[model samples]
Target: MIHPTVVSMVAAIRRRANEYMLRQLSDLGLEGLGPSHAGILGRLFQNGDMAMAEIAAAIRRDKSTVTTLVRKLEALGYVSRRKAPGDARKTLISLTPKGRALRPAYERISRELTELALEGFSSEERKALMGLLGRVRANLSLR
Candidate 1:
């Protein structure tokens, strides 16, 4: 029997990585959030404020998923959503004071995840792996 295909291996890695992030989130008292929330939070942290469609594009998720995630974050007081001043049809999401304060913890968790995933790899190996994975991702992109 085959050990496993590349797609299966990558998927397994993602599942395990998500579990690791969830456990880290739990330890940090971020109970209601999970791995899915990280992309939204991290993007907001980097880009300041962004519209729903912008967040969806940045995170590679659909607008509906971004809407749900932003709504949950707003309900939790981690983010605030409001209509854009110039465009009534566009809504922007920004981090609240509570969300802004999560930077340190978020960085720590992200760093730990990287360390855990590449614990045995040399710097060159890590770089090569990233390049290969990036190529694979690009290959699968539809647009």
Candidate 2:
């Protein structure tokens, strides 16, 4: 039996995951909330308020992309920005009440996404897969 190519399989999985997340978000009436936005939201949910540059770094996105994402979130009433204390040049981002209200749905979506991605895998297999994926990511990160 021929083995599937790693790059192709990873790409396909990423595409499917993004599509699934988009559908889930749409079903929850969150139109226009894409994966990049989700990443920012997830970070804010876990880490509370953070500076714009910090959020960008945490989400592994560039400042320009984070700027756009933050603007969209702000427009949706999901997040707000404030000037950092003692640092006029720095802007901090935090979830508004409306955004905090999304925690339950986000948790549910996260659980569903994990189950969907790992369906039929035993606990040991899941652990192994996670380790292997982490190693692959580390390998790719090397210059």
User: For residues 25-93, what per-residue lDDT tens digits would candidate 1 score against the true structure?
Assistant: 898888899899999999999999999999999989999998999989999999999999989999999
Q: Model 1 — which ten-residue stretch has the worst lDDT?
A: 134-143
Which residue pairs in model 2 clash with each other?
Answer: none
Instruction: Give the per-residue lDDT of model 2 (tens digit) for 1-143.
Output: 98888878999998998899899999999987887788899999999999999988987899999999999999999999999999999999999999999999888988999999999999999999999999988888895
Best-matching candidate per lDDT: 1
Q: For each candidate, C-alpha RMSD in Å?
A: 1.2, 1.5
Clash-forming residue pairs, model 1? none
Report, for every candidate in turn, its global Cα lDDT versus the true structure.
0.94, 0.92
